[model samples]
Target: MQTEKYRGYTLWGHAILQQEGIPQPAKFAGSGTVTRDTKVVEVSGVLDAFDSDEEAELVGLSWCRAWVDSHG
Candidate 1:
């Protein structure tokens, strides 16, 4: 997981591992959370999958930023 502050809101980007113990390389799914103060504002569904944890987390962060901008 990764964290960032955006416009007074706390955003969390998570990379959930998938396809563990397989012949192929592991995959990660992107998800996000948005919070204001100590309250939860939003929790995202699986946004997409990526080749790396960093890429997945980046996607989650982007989703969080867009949600905050559009809803705030």
Candidate 2:
């Protein structure tokens, strides 16, 4: 697990295992938006390891959950 700090939030990287080829790393980028001193984190980024956009979206959601746990 690797961590990148972004806009008061941390972006984590996880390497997806591959069976026959090189595995690409999934990047989770997030930022905190403030409204009346309340921190609302918006996690959005791409998962380059995915073969398709749909898969990327799925991976993004997983990253979102992880991001929320880490930042919330």
Candidate 1: worst-modelled 10 consecutive residues by lDDT: 17-26
- Candidate 2 residue pairs in clash (backbone atoms < 3 Å): none
Report RMSD (Å) for each prediction in the order shown.
Answer: 1.2, 10.0
Off by over 4 Å in 2: 1-40
lDDT of 2 by residue, 1-72 (tens): 344444445444444433453364443332222111244455353345544434544555456556556766
Give lDDT per model, in order: 0.94, 0.44
Give the CA lDDT, 0 to 100, for residue 29 in model 2: 30
Q: For every model shown, what is its TM-score relative to the native structure?
A: 0.93, 0.36
Cα lDDT of model 1 by residue, 4-69, tens digit? 999999999999999867798989999999999989999999999899999999899999999999
